[model samples]
Target: MDNDIKNFFKEIRKLDDNIDIPAFEEINIKRNSPRKEYYALVGIAASFLIVFSLFFTDEKVQTETNDTDYVITLSDENTTNTESLILEESSIYSWEAPSESLINNFND
Candidate 1:
């Protein structure tokens, strides 16, 4: 396994050495246009104008009063029925080993 991996890497290195790589070239970047800057300034001014108008505008919030009234009445007839209920006692369970006759019955 080690010899196979070493031979594979040696082949890759020989192939890499045989290939010709190109030289690096310089890249030229142009400056930003004045029209784009003007548009950005106009957009910023429009956003600021919108924010200031929202803060300074006079807006009246009208609240309506609820005229309907609600009344709740509780009765004492439903509170006197808990004394007639009956409850059963719970049974306790214990584990027991099986008998030798029960095991012999299964074997037959």
Candidate 2:
């Protein structure tokens, strides 16, 4: 075990001495200033539009909901409309009530 350890260390030292490290190279990564500025403006506009739409939708929904009478009126109108529809489409099956003579015959 000791002989193997010494040989491993000797080989490692020789490899380190023979190995050469490569020089550092800079990557020339570039961004167009106009494109960066345009993207920033687009992000700002998108955020503004989202906020504006939220406010607009909230206002519209409030206008619809603020009038409690309209909701009540609509509910009342719907109930009456449904009732009228039921009455209009209703069918009645009529039959004459059985007389006492009919009962007497069944007993006989």
Candidate 3:
């Protein structure tokens, strides 16, 4: 590996002995100036528009008034006794469990 590296460098030195290299040139460019006042003017205009809209906007609230009165009575001229309208215990049927036929209909 040492001999191979020495031979490589010797060949590179023999090839580079007659070659002439050129020097690098400097580039001249002019940069444009930044527009700081235009950016500040746009920001001030946006802030002024936001503040102006907040001051000029209006919100109206609506209110309604109900002046009518409602009267509720329990006993009139026709309804004299309330005992005839009472319900009995046997007249109200109790709840029971579902039958087997009713449960089988939902399985389909």
Best by TM-score: 2
Q: Can you write out model 3's per-residue Cα lDDT over 9-74, one digit (the tens) per residue?
A: 999999998897654433345444457777878899999999877665522111112223344666
Candidate 1 lowest-lDDT run of ten: 59-68
- Scored against the true structure, residue 73 in model 3 reaches a CA lDDT of 63
TM-score of 2: 0.34
Question: Which candidate model has the greater TM-score, 1 or 2?
Answer: 2
Error of 1 at 16 (Å): 21
Residue 43, candidate 3: C-alpha displacement in angstroms: 0.6
Misplaced by over 4 Å in model 2 are: 1-32, 69-108
Ranking by lDDT: 2, 1, 3
TM-score of 1: 0.29
Cα lDDT listed for each candidate: 0.71, 0.78, 0.67
Candidate 1 residue pairs in clash (backbone atoms < 3 Å): none
Q: What would the TM-scores of all predictions be?
A: 0.29, 0.34, 0.23
Most accurate candidate by lDDT? 2
